[model samples]
Target: MAAEPQTTDHRKRPRRRGDALIAAILHATVQELEERGYAALTMEGVAERARASKASLYRRWPTRAELVMDAVYSVIPDPGELPDTGELRGDLISVLTRTARLLDGPAGQALRGLMAEVLPSPERMGQVRAHAQGMGRQMMEEVTRRAVHRGEISPEALAPRRMEVGQALLRNHFLFHHEPISDEMVEEIVDEVLLPLFNTSPVNSAT
Candidate 1:
């Protein structure tokens, strides 16, 4: 007698949760971006690669741009509290170097793609700048705050432009020159620009 035909059970992929799920999605995003470039990236493709549903991605990140930005930012080290090197210049250099290194990898590629796509849309450009510059500013603030506490700089030294100078110079070099930021360039920014801005004594005015 012939045996009854066996049935194949089609099962849905197991649900991924919490950090594991996010990690898988992020990894898939980077892989997709690297392989297909930003223009070819899609929510459907990422979900397929991640073995997750499109609903899962949309729930976390409402748009493709948001998802890509989050993936890029994930690789960047949190500024946290940096070690106090006991000097302003050393602290600035250390923090700036870290930022430069982050921009040299996947974050850099994502940024280039984001800029090209978003430049034509003012709203999108604003979103991109806020996401990118916000992190840099936070790092700079941490470095500068420590300097103030150490008496290396005064409260008056905390000006908006002064706080922004280090990251701005580093970003300018990266965006325009499109080269890996060098130790020499980092030093130049700290020495030639930031140090003077932070350390300079205010000019006295005669009434």
Candidate 2:
């Protein structure tokens, strides 16, 4: 009888580590979200897809929501200070347009899904808002500061409520309209709404 051929075991590959592991997990998470969506995604699925252990995933992310958020944020760029385009209107348009473009991608999908999942829990909802809205306000504040320095707008225009106007409109359109944001809409937002608001003098409460 011929000796039995030895079989190589392929199931015991070395585990991915450090940045490689993180990249694999994040990539797998996004793929799973795109394929299965937030409601159906689980740690087991992500781990299997990443060729990692469940323990590895759990060690990094304590909850499904956190993991999904991380995956989504990984692909999105931080909204650093806006470029000084010389004119306030141009800068505002640039900021709003960039925001609209980001919301048109996987980041948008992940956000919508997260809202649906976390809305029932006040704590989770607050966390999501802090991450999403907080960043938007921060970017707007920076842009507003730049405009002030350039003498494009009065310092009195830099109010908390004013900073939120652009992002609020953008988020409303995104959540309700279910369509890619258009340049016309962004222009309208800048020209019709934000520019007028910033240029107007603040009303005196004592009057």
Give the clash count for each candidate: 0, 0
lDDT of each: 0.83, 0.84
lDDT of 2 by residue, 70-174 (tens): 898776556564676888888888888888987887678878989998999999999888887777787788777887898878888787878888988999999
- In Å, residue 117's CA in model 2 sits off its true spot by 0.9
lDDT of 1 by residue, 24-56 (tens): 999999889888878889999998888888888
Model 1 clashing residue pairs (backbone): none
For model 2, the superposed segments whose C-alpha errors exceed 4 Å read 1-20, 201-207
What lDDT is reached at residue 78 by model 1?
75
Instruction: Compare the candidates by TM-score and give the number of the best one.
Output: 1
Cα RMSD for candidates in order: 4.5, 4.1
Q: Largest lDDT belongs to which candidate?
A: 2
Counting only residues 3 or more apart in sequence or on different chains, how many pairs clash (N, Cα, C under 3 Å) in candidate 2?
0
Window of ten residues with lowest summed lDDT in model 1: 198-207
